[model samples]
Target: MPTDTRARMVTGAARMISRRGVDAMSLRELAEQEGVPLGSTYHHFPGGKAELVDAAVNHVGDRVAESIAGTRGQGTEHIVRWVLHAWRRILIKSDFRAGCPVLAAAVAKDERHRDTARAVFGRWTDGLIDVLIEDGVPPVRAPSVARTIIASLEGAVGLARAFGQIGPLDDVEAELIRLVAAAAGEPAPGAGR
Candidate 1:
């Protein structure tokens, strides 16, 4: 089905972006990866690589947003743990070859890709902030905490990918879980009043 083909193209692009960064993506390679003809790439994405890249970035962003949704009514530690492991799995599954697609887009040289990255970043930050607030993080602190988590995670993922190991992310995860618990005024692990 054309629908499946289009979705495959987007997925292939996302994976490519995750692994190699946006600078290395090619529409033709994406078509090949999806088993679709080169022309179909254009047929599905009228704006060509730019459109495909936009879709790819959005696809990854939406997946993260969906994961955040599952943390509704959970504590900040729960939310923090879920997000860190979710991203960790990506590194483990990809053998540390892939990083975040949104990061790739954010650092892309093109203006269109940069704009798309901005929207995805906002969506991710806003989604996390909402859950942090729900988990009793003070509204005044939620945004700053959410931003720090996102920023740290992004950096950690990059470093982990660079070294072909997950230590950086794991270290950051530990710190984030602690920070989240502190932000929500929860007792630290194994601590007593």
Candidate 2:
């Protein structure tokens, strides 16, 4: 719904990549999907498909990091639930057709795409680690706990998409809350609710 053609193209490319991945997403299809002329894609992304893919990856990555950062004082359980609910909504809204754009890029054959994913994942993990530390999780354990949460959620998203259900995400969310609670030395909120 972005009025700017370039922004629309980037958002559309992210959605396309979520479903079809990097190698399978063609610029021409992206143009048609975004209702932009093929030449405009070149104008906006002079580096061609690689440039567009990078932009799309960064777009999704920034959005996700910002979302996580927004939950600074909401407590660990709320943060975990919020993140899982966001993914669950995406799965249901897209009819299980879409997964994470960054994950899609990470699995691509292109080294550049993988590198972008690595940086994005690092940023997300760092943000979560900071939030965990804020919630009283030991600094020593926050990093590993953050990484585990992200890795498990990413895998759960893929499983949810593949199985056409959100059960995988739900299961991961429950376990993640317990993992985080244990790390924070606090009782798990709504434990086994």
Candidate 3:
């Protein structure tokens, strides 16, 4: 099954824009990277740069939601592990120099882009919240807990990247495991120290 050229171009552009800020992108540059002709780019997105950016933002959001949906219905531990592995893959794919795609777009001024970013992040939080609620957290608290975990993980990634070491991520991972365990009233491994 062959994918339509526009969809392929959008997918490639979304990956590139996620790894490199939108401000640094151009249609010509995207065409070159995608190996698609300039005429085809305009044929697919006649509105040009703004339209391309919009498509890219939505494309990335859908990609993220699809990834999270695949990991649904296991357990909180599984979700946590999936998140860690996903973050590691993103970090490596971007050469450890880029912030998260949704996070970057959140700080960007374009309202539509930010909305797309928020939608993507909301899906991730909601997915994790479902796992947390299943693990016995109060339904009302699950979303907040999920958000805290996400914020902490992002912060840990930033710190680790800034220091050029993975210690921050490792510490955050261990602490996340411990926090989730304690929330479930499971005995922490090395308690009573």
The candidate that wins on lDDT is 2
- TM value for model 1: 0.90
**Pairs that clash in candidate 1:** none
Model 1 scores a C-alpha lDDT of 0.84
- Overall local distance difference test of candidate 3: 0.73
lDDT of 1 by residue, 1-193 (tens): 4498898898999999988789889877877887899999889899988889999999988988777777777755776677677777878888888888998998898988989888988887898898888777777788898999889988998898889887887799889988887888854335574
Higher-ranked by TM-score: 1 or 2: 2
Ranking by lDDT: 2, 1, 3
* Candidate 2: regions farther than 4 A off: 1-3, 186-193
The clash tally of candidate 3 reads: 0
TM-scores of all predicted structures: 0.90, 0.92, 0.81
lDDT for each residue of candidate 3 in 1-193, tens digit (9 for 90 to 100): 4257788778777776666667666688788878888888888888886677777777766766676667666667776676677767766666776556666667666787778778877887887787777786666667777888888887977876677666777788888877766676643335567
Better of 2 and 3 by TM-score: 2
In angstroms, the error of model 3 at 78 is 1.4
Cα deviation at 119, candidate 1, in Å, is 0.9
Q: Which pairs of residues collide in candidate 2?
A: none
